[model samples]
Target: MKSFWCEQAWLPDGIASRVLVRADRGTITSVSTVDTIPLGCERLYGVVLPGFANAHSHAFHRALRGRTHSDGGTFWTWRDRMYAVAERLTPESYLHLARAVYAEMAIAGVTAVGEFHYLHNGGNEMGEALRQAAVDAGIRLTLLDACYLAGGIGQPVTGVQERFSDGTGERWAARVAELREDGNTRVGAAIHSVRAVPRETLSLVAGAFPDRPLHVHLSEQPAENEACLAAYGLTPTELLHEAGALTARTTAVHATHLSTKDIGLLGSAGTGACFCPTTEADLADGIGPARELRDAGSPLSLGSDQHAVIDPLLEARGLEHGERLRTGERGRFTPADLVAALTNHAAVGWPEAGRIEVGAPADLVAIGLDSVRTTGCAADQVVLAATASDVAVVVSGGKVVARNGVHETLGDVGKLLKAVV
Candidate 1:
């Protein structure tokens, strides 16, 4: 059993002072308000938030963070550089890189990550490496194994994309079926995109793991939508809807370029929209219709896709900032809304995580109210005002894994990342 006392904790109802949380075997057993600290409890100061869930990621892309922007280029040019990194990674090298990436996520207050992995290399070894890396770094992982079959809408696999395809959709399913879930890892499925997956195969990938979470990269770039429309005579969203892939369990990552009809299809189908605001901005992927998507019925979640920035706080701020810049109005999403998106563990298939309540995983993140970045901000407004540097303590699954941007057992995350990337 473990116990922790929070100065202020974000409860389901609202923020509560002097909150005492008790956990047993990684499950939160009880939460209550108390006036005095218990004798043996760990005390967490400042504002305590539920752990952030990075709902979309590609771990290997962390290597290309600062290396791809020397020359200004479109998303396609940036992807060419990304593919080069993917080609060089083996199972052993990827393990080290992902361990560092996950540790960096932990220190930034992210407890779980949904990796949209498409680097198959013709087997499950790469996926196995990612699973081991997550365990080593002390965070939960949803391996959203992506099915990438084509070079484009109708083109065959070419160049480095050969490593991403399993030859066919059936082969992809067989490879995925071999992946087993453990206490800290869940196996999910993803369609890389309408462009990468042919229409005939989209349904197979979506139905491969029906009981698990299904994610897809949806219209992140205008070129993709244009290509998809030119080939299929239907928008990407319409193609996905036609294939019956738009469901509550399905999440459309980067539903950025969408029409009125497309938004309705996603919203009415109850598909989640995961916005990687930092990466979208870094790649100049354009501002997505985040608020409009939510209003129409899609739930919103956040992620650090390319590792251009690994801060969930900054992603939250960027989400709202993008909305402000696009709409010329403030408060597009309230702080509570942002918090909900930040901790939506269900978006990554961890339905019982991301809450400071009984029966949930005992994941907690303590943000320093006294830090220079967050010094005078209101408790509710900290999401907008603070950065990852404000995170003082990160507890995952009832265990303290990181403190002040350093992993408890892995030592310095910066050193780990520096060695790998």
Candidate 2:
């Protein structure tokens, strides 16, 4: 059993003071809003918030950070370099890279992660090697094993993309079945995109994982939209709908170029939408319908996407930045909403996570209430002011991974990260 006594903690509804929280094994056992410190529990001061859930990520992409920025190109061109890096990763190298990257995320206060895993079929064991790497990294991974077939609408996977593709949806299913889930890792599916995947496989993938999380990249580029429209005679969202892919368990990533009906079907189908704001802006993917989707009551979450910037605090803030730019208003997104996106929206996208309420896993981040960022701020100010650097302590599953911004597993992540870049 472990207990945390804090001066302030962010409850689901709002911020409260003098909180004492207890955990047994991994789940929260007890929670109290009392000012008095407990007898034998560990005491930690400052502001405690729910551990941020990274809804989407590619762990290996952490290596390609600064290298991607120096080149000025579209997402397609950027992918070429990414593929070259992807080709060189062995299971051992991947584990080493992912361990260091997840440690970086822990330091930034991300308690759990949804790894959009696609690298598969190098060894005799296939992607089993890659899945094991995430388990060793100490972050809860949702392996979104992708069905990458075509290079584009008609082009076939040749060199590096061969690893991402199986013979067909049948082969993909056989491989997906090979993945065994553990407490820390859950296997999921991604349809890659209309460009890299066939439309027919959408049904095959989703139906196989009924009631499980299914994420797909939708209309991220104007070119992708035009191509899907030209080939399939519909936008990517409509094609998925026709193939019975969009459902309650599905999440449509970067629905940036959806039609009025596309957005309507998304909200009506109860599909979750994940907006990777930083990647969207960097790739010139254009402003997503953030306000529109929120108004339509679609569940919204955030993702680091390419690891261009791995900070969830900034990801939360970037969502607001996109909304503000579109609406010509500041404070467009409330602190409560952003916190939910960073925390509990993980629940909608990842049913296993999302909030800090009891019975939820004891994943949390503690920030200094008196830090320079929060010098004159209050509860809302905690989110408004704090950055990833201000995250002082990170606990995932009742185990302290980072304390005072120092990761216990990896020392000086920035210094190590530079080696790959």
Candidate 3:
């Protein structure tokens, strides 16, 4: 059992002051207002929000962060460099790299991550490495095992792409079934893209895991849409709809190049859209219709895809900043909306998390109100003004995992990343 007295807390209804939160076995048991501080309860100052959820991630892509920018390449060219990194990773090396990368996420106030994993070296060795990495980093993991069968719409796997293929969709399912979930891990499914998974196998991958979260890389570049249309006469969103892939449990990553019809189809099905604003900008991918997708009935979430930047606060700020730049208007999304997207654990299959109320996971992030970036900001609007550096303390599963940019169990995250990267 553990207890914390918060100076300010983001409750479901609104922000509250002098709140007491109690937890037992990693779940919140009660929350109430208190006039006096209690003994033995940890003190958490400033505004404590629910821990952020990174909805879409490619953990191995962390290796390509600063190395890919010098050439000033396009997304296709970037893929060539990314492939170079993927080919060299063994399960042993991946565990070291992913452990360090997840530690970086932990200090950024990320309590849970949806790793869009596709780099399966012909078996579950890589997936098991990721599961253990998250455990060592003291965070929850949803290993979104991806099915990659084709190099393109009609192209066959070549080079390092061969490692991602499972020969058939049934074979992919059989291997994914071997992945077991424990207390810190959940197993989910991902369709690598409409380009990699063919028209016939889309439904097979979609229905393979009937009760888990499903994600897909949707229309990140114009060339993908062009190839998809030229081959099947349907946009990526339309193709997924045809295959019965869009649903309340589905999240379409990088919905940047969608048509109005594509947006409508995804919205009507209650499918979620996860925008990696920093990655989209880093890869020269245009700003997605985040406002349009939200208004169209699709829920919105955020990610650090590729880790050009790993700060969830920056990702949330970039989300609004991108909207303003797109429409020439400010305040496109409210601070509350950005916070909601930041803590959208449901997008990653943890429906009971991302809240501070009773029965939810006791994951909390304490942001210092007096930090250099957050001084003089309103309590409710700090999401707009703060960065990950303002994170004073991070609590996941009712345990303090990080403090002041330093991981609790792993020591210095920078040195860990320096050793691996």
lDDT of each: 0.94, 0.78, 0.95
Question: Across residues 57-83, which tens digit of lDDT does each residue of candidate 2 receive?
Answer: 887887777776675878878889889
lDDT per residue for candidate 1 within 1-421, as digits (tens), equals 9999999999999999999999999999999999889999989999999999999999999999788878898898999999899999999999999999999999999999999999999899999999999999899999999999999877999999999999899999999999999999999999999988999998898898899999999999898988888888899999999999999999999999999999999999999999999999999999999998999999999999999999999999888999999999999999999999999999999999888999999999999999888889999888989899989999999999999888999999988999998
The digit string of per-residue lDDT tens for model 3 on 1-421 reads 9999999999999999999999999999999999989999989999999999999888889988889878697999999989999999999999999999999999999999999999999999999999999998989999999999999999999999999999999999999999988899999999999999999999999999999999999999999999999999999999999999999999999999989999999999999999999999999999999999999999999999999999999999999999999899999999999999999999999999999999999999999999889889999999999989999999999999999999999999999998988
lDDT of 1 at 45: 94
What TM-score would candidate 1 get against the native? 0.99
Model 1: residue 200 alpha-carbon error in angstroms: 0.9
Candidate 3 local lDDT, residue 211: 98
The count of backbone overlaps in candidate 3 is 0
Model 3 reaches what TM-score against the true structure? 0.99
Error of 3 at 237 (Å): 0.6
Which regions of candidate 3 are displaced past 4 Å? none
Clashing pairs in 2: 343-354, 344-354
Q: Higher TM-score: candidate 2 or 3? A: 3
Candidate 1, 405: how far from true, in Å? 1.1
- Two-way lDDT contest, 1 vs 3, winner: 3
